[model samples]
Target: MKLPLAARVQEAGAALAAEASRFSGYGWMRGTSGNLSIVLDRDPLVLAVTASGLDKSELTDRDVVLIDADGEALDSDDPRPPSAEAGLHAHIAARTGAGAVFHVHAFDAVVAGHRWPGGVEIRDMEMLKGIGHRANDETVTIPVIANDQDMRVEAARFDEVYVAATAEVPEVPALIVANHGMYAWGADVAAARRHLEITEWLLRFAVATR
Candidate 1:
């Protein structure tokens, strides 16, 4: 079926919603603890982001809000706020050219965060290939920064991590925040979904083995 651009966007939003539900089932986004976003357009800058405090499993098109690069609300008569971590998502999108960003608080990521103040190293795992990076015998050190409540501070920390990380693995798709959650992005919504799922799987495996 030839869906209009709006319909296509809605479809993508629905896909993101479904992904959120799956994450919830896995206990990744428990008790309204996570957010999801997809780029509707990039040139003029429009992102379809999840509204704050909504149960992800019950998400609908109306639950999504359109925002600009500055994170200003662009569409929707509803005065609903975007997720609290919207700034972090915006920062990643602006810096990485990612078409979508997904954040969730999975047990592995949170537990690993509590242990690794610097970061966690996942080396030689075949799953690394799923994150659009080469999986080799070499160690893939995924840096984990201490979690912060201030979004601005959190965003700045991410900026530092981005610069340092690009110096090593310039194309890694996801990052971890200690005791917080994970941030994964990709070239488009589907690609972003792949990155999120792959990173989550890797973390789950790492935790299980450790």
Candidate 2:
């Protein structure tokens, strides 16, 4: 008998919580500013994601909430809200066909976004290989969306700007929110982590080269 999707979501939550904590240890999540998720299913749209306002260092499996594609809580764990940015996570996952998404309020993303209103261009860097950046343009461009208090508005804005293509903007594994942070995604948690690391690295690399 196959495990129920809910059960699998729960399992994924447990695993993701550990990974999120590790990210916290890297000083990334810093006081609940970051969130992580694992997609249970894409069609029915179930996800195991961190809860809102919880300290990432102390996050447990219970801190991970199951939500639908719309970011509505589904696991019925005393109605505690999902991450405030869950909608953005869902939007990225849906748009990119990612199985996992990770968001972090890292320093490089914030600095880079503040410097570039249009987008951040990472050119001629070896680190680009980590996130699968391959293009004739010889550079990786990560879009930046201005942060908004109303996450719904921000999510909608994200929907408008974040289209990936080879000849156009190109498919970056990540995008930054101005003065907010970056969201990185991939086919799984490990891959998403790699994307996050590479994206953050590219920002720092850009700064270092300057």
Candidate 3:
């Protein structure tokens, strides 16, 4: 009893748009600096992603573009051009099987990353449970990668660190790019929202307490 692809995409697009609007309320994405995406189908690989340069607060499903695995727009000949970081979304989906990927340039994330260029470690925080930390005093280290203007190059650099982390910690819900921003993904849109919210929460907490 699965819904048709178009209907599903429409539903996902609406959800993504709503989430984007909510996140845009945050000062970080207030100027259209964040991007969000939700997967529609995996076989042919379709994604409903935010179109580039549009104000997230003003976006609805209309601004979501359906793109393939290769980041080709499937919906419109001029699909408003998907976000510049669409490639990162595609890569995260491929590696994590995540249904949604959310990226934001929060001041807290930048501050935390700058404060700890190697990465940020949040330990003994109750909020860490949001990202699935079990132990009360568990330490969670978010690996940070250097940034590149060419996102494809950035994606490759991310893969190297992401791949290497598999040996020690495999279920990485979010990653930070040095002075860039944070990317969070999860099984679906709701989970992605949870991860994104708490990751930003954790960053803000880290910056505040330090």
Candidate 4:
């Protein structure tokens, strides 16, 4: 039997908290710097997102808030505001049909975005396979957009740079905001986590080498 929407939301909250804790341990989500989200409904696009201003490492299962496709809070009783970047998460979900999205303030991601404002070009690395790219001669460009205080504007900037996956190339599952951080998505929470980790590792490698 399918779980009720309310139950699904609670389940998503717990799952997001666990993922948040993992990222926090890596120092990628220092203080309350990062956010994670899971899709709860696709028809109208509901999401369970981490609440604003909470320590990522200390999140409980109840720490999440429900938000709509426009990033507006759907649960009026919940006083917590969704993460400031929730709109970007929504846009990515709507655009890519991703089930989960993660954003982290990893040092290497910020550094690489600053160094490569256009986009980061990576090629011929075995780690590339982790992000669904070829491990041999294929080149993948992780899109980077300038940071904006307004997430709506930021989402627009993302749309300007996003490239759809072609038959010959898979879509880049991640993006970087200049001087800010990176956002990664996948079919589900675990896949999103893996993509985020692999993308961060690639950024670290790029920063170290360049």
**Which candidate has the highest TM-score of all?**
4
Q: Lowest-lDDT window of 10 residues in candidate 1?
A: 163-172
Clashing pairs in 2: none
Give TM per candidate. 0.87, 0.90, 0.91, 0.98
Q: Against the unseen true structure, what C-alpha lDDT does each candidate score?
A: 0.78, 0.82, 0.81, 0.92
Clash list (residue pairs), candidate 4: none
Candidate 4 accuracy as lDDT: 0.92
Candidate 4 similarity to native, TM-score: 0.98
| Candidate topping lDDT | 4
Rank by lDDT, descending? 4, 2, 3, 1
Candidate scoring better on lDDT of 1 and 4: 4
The local lDDT score (0 to 100) that residue 186 gets in candidate 3 is 90
Residue-pair clash count for candidate 4: 0
Off by over 4 Å in 4: none
Kindly give the stretch of ten consecutive residues in candidate 3 with the minimal lDDT sum: 163-172
* Displacement of the residue 142 alpha carbon in candidate 1, Å: 1.5
How far off is residue 36 in model 1, in Å? 0.4
Residue 122 error, candidate 2, Å? 0.9
lDDT of 3 by residue, 5-114 (tens): 77887787789889888888886677778889998878877788888888888887677877788776786666488887887888788777889999988788888888
